[model samples]
Target: MPDAQLRPEPFIQQTAPAALEDLRARLRATRWPDTPEDAGWSLGTDLDYLRELVTYWAEDFDWPAQEARLARLPRFRVPLGGLGIHFVHARATAPTTPALPLVLSHGWPDSFWRYSKVVPLLTDPGAHGGDPADAFDVVVPDMPGYGYSDRPAGPPLDSVAVAGLWAELMTVLGYERFGAAGGDVGSHVSRYLGLDHPDRVVAVHRTDGGLPVFTGDPADLTQEERSWIDGAAAWGAVEGAYAAIHRTKPQTAAFGLTDSPAGLAAWIVEKLRSWSDSDGDIERSFTKDEILTNITLYWLTGTIGSSMRMYRANAAIPPAQHARRVEVPSGFSLFPGEPVLPPRAWLERTTNMVRLTEPARGGHFAAFEEPEAYAQELRDFFRPYRTGTAAD
Candidate 1:
């Protein structure tokens, strides 16, 4: 049981008008940078698009309306592990059937906002044209140093630490056993939950396992596994610099990003465009408003630096920790646009693989990009495990 003193307090999303005005001033006064002609996102965030985005952010983007929308969700903050962790805890709405408690963790470059679109669908499946039995009492927490969660004053918290925090959080909410699912860094945390707390996490689901970490002889790996390993390395060589920076010198990068909203947007939006199933058209996957809403959250919270520090802490995790395979039943949905797909052989080696899926759409931020399909995948994968009520 959780400590009775550690009760959750209701939280509301409210930013002062002065802060919003200050953001507009900064956006309007952005010092534009030069980009080679015809570079068109190949070099980085497209200059033209960024300029247009900054203009919209300065003049048209409505923060109050978005804040109101976010506040409509059941949000709370609880003092756990000496930090006031913020989360959205919505009960399942099915009338007769009891809902399963499922915790959804979000990765970097996003917060709980990543799962906002799909929360309703999961918490009330019947309302979204799915079975009520599939309902989940959804809990989406902002990882330490992300979104509204408090930043660690000491060393940053890694996946393992965050998983422990999550376990305690579930206990505080009175959920003894539950399911876990996430993508990106969240996937790493979810894996740890299944590993470190296997007795409690019923099953684990993830989009991609963290970068391949094989220590055995190459001869033992299948051809597909070798290719997958090589592919991951190749992708990292070309596109993983952001992560490298996060792991090494996030503070140096943080100064500029913290002061300049445009710089922050360029740093994050580039990944959003490159990692999504947008086909060179980012707006296809996310509207300008949607993009700004996420970026604005980072700016308001002033958490970009602390969030990146998670990489630094995770980089210090020993090789033996990476080698440990999860014992809990696991599911993977390799979305089509995900940069490097973990082959079944690798997932089998790393997890107790029970399900593998190739969804027709989406990319890195699938939950936000294709909420309907993403929600349906969860509904189908966890259906068999939904054996008890939310209060059981």
Candidate 2:
């Protein structure tokens, strides 16, 4: 048990039957879009394939079994500024090595489930044929309004506030300092942790390698910068419609996504397939149960609205505010297939980059998509800083 000053665990049992029933009802009432021959994925999600996935999700998928599997992990909740934040605190059973306290933050559309596979790899590295000295006392939190955590009543769930709450959570768990890492929105939040609370975070790592907000300054860019800009522009042309919608009218978009399970699944699954290292097909890497479990967490907790609001809220902040430089030691594990991949020079301005590695595989969801390599990157990067840190 943690300190009594911290709020006791607030456990919410998942409703598998309710999730299945919701899927069935939504699929039965879905409105289909007409498509001509050879339309393919060029037209966003293929209607035929989506319908097939919806059918399996409603009829054949085993939600209860998945829920039972999740229940095996030790879960808890703690009060942070009047909101209950849910997290999984899994400790390694290893007796020979010291376990470093590390926090893993999940990005938009991905729940803490993203860390499930990587947790054992990190918390019990010896079991996976890795150095026991690299093991971590893993703490994976569901960002406010994302999982079992209830919605915040006051300010929106911005990156800085989320990082502050994480600091407090670690303190509550008795760690005076810790290491943090994330990808996508998680990457930004982890950067903020290093920037805003460097005294508490030993080191920080990100998979996206801090994306710069473009300002059309061609003269300021190097050859690599220009290439990255070109790639980002092309990606925005094909796949950034979701960003525009989320930034402009999250409330309007939330109504349909929050009300219909199918709508929510399509919106999220598109990102998972497009941004993950699954070779463009989600089913190739993750089971249908895995996909639905993530989406269901959003729908069941009524956080679709709040989650989208992060986009709108972030947009409201000034570009200069978002572009503030991070002074803490930061590492980047640039995955091969993320939306906006930044070159080292571009990222160096935004972060105090200490180490940068370009992985041959993985995408935005590196922890889940490439657990072994992702865990190894984390292990090697933080291993040197593990001693003399408050996290120990």
Candidate 3:
């Protein structure tokens, strides 16, 4: 049977009253942990802040309202390669012409919520003070085992395997060719899209340099490259222990997160706060509702374990496959506050570097933090590649 005939069905948000009540019960009965007065966030998530947030979550935060808002978007699920993939398919609005198709891949601790703010901006740039010609039909999918998608039931699926699924997903969506972009784990998935589907991918855009894509003779390394390697080592030593746990003992860690909502929040919220460009106040980047909405998705869906297991699967991919050069036309918009901001030379060394821009602000969750800028980056990068354009 043809892939499209898999019959993608409309998906709606309708959490049971029982589930919401149970969540509140858990939050209310949270086993609070004591903290040192001076520890602050030095040891981990601030207990003082978590107490306030949890209070608000149980007493005032609105999941039904958020769910209603999210339900307004066009969302659907389709059976692809035995996995049910949920996605938002937002078409270009009030388009001056037909918009180009674009697929956005996202990483852990987030589902399709990563691009929630940027969707309207990309789909209707005119409403946001941009040209209508810049609009794009955006497809933001919840990767297998994340959000409403089904957990993988067989052998592990790595980035390359996921890319193959994505290529098929685009085909199933009736797109013969499209542009691609992503960051974090999604950036690696996007890399494989360009690497394996150059014939169908119009162009590739990324926020980070998609590390681990570099491996060669030591003699070929430049001083800047050496510095980047050393800096990455330093960053990992301090900030990458969570990933180590995910890679080495995700099942052990998942036990706590899966059973306790508070535990889940601490594990996920720490990253949301630490990796963002919030300075010291994460609220500056994400409101309490925004943070809880993402956390609630994981808590309600029970996918934290599956999400972390992705790291272990990816770790097994051979270096040769990891380091393959991307030949598709590529562009990048490096954010200053993101985990690793690569030099232009480093980007050029990794892919078929075509366009590169360093935005003055934003971080890993740039789309969520700075929607307009992120939307503009996509518009500018994919402008020349759009099929209806004179250049094309």
Best by lDDT: 1
For each candidate, C-alpha RMSD in Å? 1.0, 2.3, 2.1
lDDT of 2 by residue, 312-346 (tens): 66676567666678787889998886767888888
Clash list (residue pairs), candidate 3: none
Q: 2 or 3, which is superior by lDDT? A: 3
- Each candidate's TM vs. the true structure? 0.98, 0.93, 0.97
The TM-score obtained by model 3 is 0.97
Q: How many backbone clashes can be found in candidate 2?
A: 0
Lowest summed lDDT across 10 adjacent residues in model 2 is found at: 1-10
TM-score of 2: 0.93
Q: Candidate 3 — worst ten consecutive residues by lDDT sum?
A: 383-392
Candidate 3 stretches greater than 4 Å from native: 1-4, 388-392
- Expressed as tens digits, the lDDT of each residue in 1-392 for candidate 1 is 65687899999978999999999999989999888889988888999999999999999999999999999899999988999899999999954466788999999899999999999999988898988878899999999999999999999999999999999999999888899999999999999999999988989989887799888899999999999899999999999999999999999999999999999999999999999999989999999999999999999999999999999999999999998999899999989888888889999999999999999999999999999999999989988887753553
Q: lDDT of candidate 1?
A: 0.93
Q: What lDDT score belongs to each candidate, Candidate 1 first?
A: 0.93, 0.80, 0.87
Ranking by lDDT: 1, 3, 2
The number of the candidate with the highest TM-score is: 1
lDDT of 3 by residue, 96-180 (tens): 8778889999987798999998999999999999999999989999988788889997755788888888888778777878889
